[model samples]
Target: MANIDPIDARILARLQRRCDEPLEELGQHVGLSRNAVWRRVKALEERGVLVGRVAVVDPDAVGLGLMVFIQVRAGHHSADWLEKFRRAVRAMPEILGVYRMTGDLDYLLRARVADMADYDRLYQRLIARVDMGDVSASFVMEELKEGSALPL
Candidate 1:
């Protein structure tokens, strides 16, 4: 990966805030020419600094209003068991994210659902599918902040 200099950082900042900005507009914002900005953006992509652009969607608008974080601990932590659990979680559409952790729990899962009833059914399915000996989950009451921007 290329080291992000001041110019590169500026380009990233502008791009993060407005991905649809034209090359010339981005160049003006970053104090570079149109072609320079285009090359920098391409370089960033090549270096894997800029991954992919995506549109942020409203969960409530999509009818998946409830947010949940589920903690899971398995009966054992063998590699095969972990892989199986991961594969099982990956297949569930309701599960938005999954992370293996260093804390007491083996895995942390983020899921979205319509309501408590929906979550209950999802939880039951998870219990049936995962090789978990312990499971705990908490519902998100509020979203204080949510964003993917990283300060340069």
Candidate 2:
């Protein structure tokens, strides 16, 4: 990553909160000219700091009422096993997020389903495909807060 000074951080903070803000408005917020603000945004993108803009959707409204987190312990820790597991998880639309972790678990996965029955089906499918030694999962009781916006 390139050195992100205070100005760049401020620009990114404003952009995250209001991506559709015009160049003039964004520049004003960060004390830069419209052209300068535009250049900063472009540079941020080129440096991979600003990945992409996305629409945050409501999972419950979209027929995904159940939020589940699965901690998986694989039977083997080989490159082939890891690749296969990743590809399998990526192909599943219900699997919202996946992460490799440092713990007893090899992978941590976030999935959204309709209900308990739906999650059960997903669990069976996941284990059958990946040969995980152990699978532990928990349903989210409540979501206090979740957002992509940075604290900056």
Candidate 3:
């Protein structure tokens, strides 16, 4: 990350909590003028520090309470297989996040499903498109922490 001053850090910290924080309030919090704060915010965006903001929704509220993490091991480590795997996983709306990690597991997929039946349907669709050597799944029983705050 680019080196940010104390004022910039304060701006980001507040923005992270509420991206659309009023300029006057944010300026008062960081001891700067509203226009100055606006300038700095624009500069931060230009530097790519502040990308974009979106609303955070609860999975349970959307009827996707169950969280399942699926680890995929490659059946065939080839270009065509990888491309198909990527496409298959991306097409599933239930699959919220996918990651290619540097460990034993080749890919990790985080899926938000309604229940076991929903997850099974997703699994069947996934396997029908791309092959997996080993697929392991874990259900989250509880969510202890979920936040978008980054350590500043």
Indicate which candidate wins on lDDT.
3
Summing lDDT over every window of 10 consecutive residues in candidate 3, give the lowest-scoring window.
1-10
The digit string of per-residue lDDT tens for model 3 on 1-152 reads 36899899999999988988899999999999999999999999998988988787888999999999999999899999999998999899999899998989999999999999999999999999998999999999999997887877
For candidate 1, report its TM-score.
Answer: 0.92
TM-score of each: 0.92, 0.90, 0.90
Model 2, runs deviating above 4 Å: none
TM-score ranking, best first: 1, 2, 3
Which window of ten consecutive residues has the lowest lDDT sum in model 2?
Answer: 53-62
What is the lDDT of every predicted structure here?
A: 0.89, 0.88, 0.93
Query: What is the overall TM-score of model 2 with all chains considered together?
Result: 0.90
Clashing pairs in 2: none
Query: Which pairs, if any, clash in model 3?
Result: none
Which regions in candidate 3 have their CA more than 4 angstroms from the true location?
Answer: none
Tens digits of per-residue lDDT for model 2, 1-152: 25988999999898788788899999988899999999989999999999998766788888898899998888788998888898889888899999989977888999999999999999888777887878899999899987788776
Please provide, for model 1 over 1-152, each residue's C-alpha lDDT reduced to its tens digit, 9 standing for 90 to 100: 25889999999988887798899989987889999999999999999999998888899999999999998888677888887887889889999999989977878999999999999999988878766889999999999997788887
| Model 2 residue 47 distance off true place after TM-score fit, in angstroms | 1.1
In candidate 1, stretches whose alpha carbon ends up further than 4 angstroms from where it belongs are none
